[model samples]
Target: MARRPKLFEAAPGSPAETRCQLCERAVRHTSRHHLVPREEGGRYGPTVDLCQPCHSSVHLLLTNKELARRYHTVEDLQRAEELQKYLHWIRRSRVERITNRRRRR
Candidate 1:
């Protein structure tokens, strides 16, 4: 028999959070992230589902040029030295959503 999806893994009508490709956490909310930036001619490129904090961290740490040139794949992003510290901390935390934050203009 096929394995059943866990509680948050299954969303009836809406797309569930599933697993974050980066931190490997199952968040209640997730966003699709393009490996190659959409603005950098990757509008139709590959994407991975990332949790809110992981997704936000990616943008906060890297620029579109860096993403397009270096960290365009999940494996590459995971090995990024800049994200090591944040990843280590987030992996041990239970908080799904990062509370305090600022929006980039």
Candidate 2:
């Protein structure tokens, strides 16, 4: 029998070990998303745990231009109370979107 490497060990120093900063979901097989734009001095921080669908939805619904203008990195977001508020807002919005779609029978 072969032993699989722990996810954290495979991706050493990854932020996925932490629950999604937005929805509080445990991150698994997650991709790294810069809360702040790297080009704008954004660095890594708490990340959202989005299953592939959720991750795609976020990018589709929220434009890159908007993200670039709003948050360049997690560090930048942590500095602003308003952005923090929006983090929760975005989480709720995602839940609502998912729920509403499920209920549209």
How far is each candidate from the true structure, as Cα RMSD in Å? 8.0, 9.9
TM-score of each: 0.78, 0.38
Q: How far is candidate 1 from the true structure (C-alpha RMSD, Å)?
A: 8.0
- Candidate 1 backbone collisions, by pair: none
Runs in model 1 deviating more than 4 A are 1-17, 99-105
The candidate that achieves the highest lDDT relative to the unseen native structure: 1
Cα lDDT over the full model 1: 0.83
How does model 2 score by TM-score?
A: 0.38
Evaluate residue 21 in candidate 2 and report its C-alpha lDDT on the 0 to 100 scale: 42
lDDT score of residue 77 within candidate 1: 94
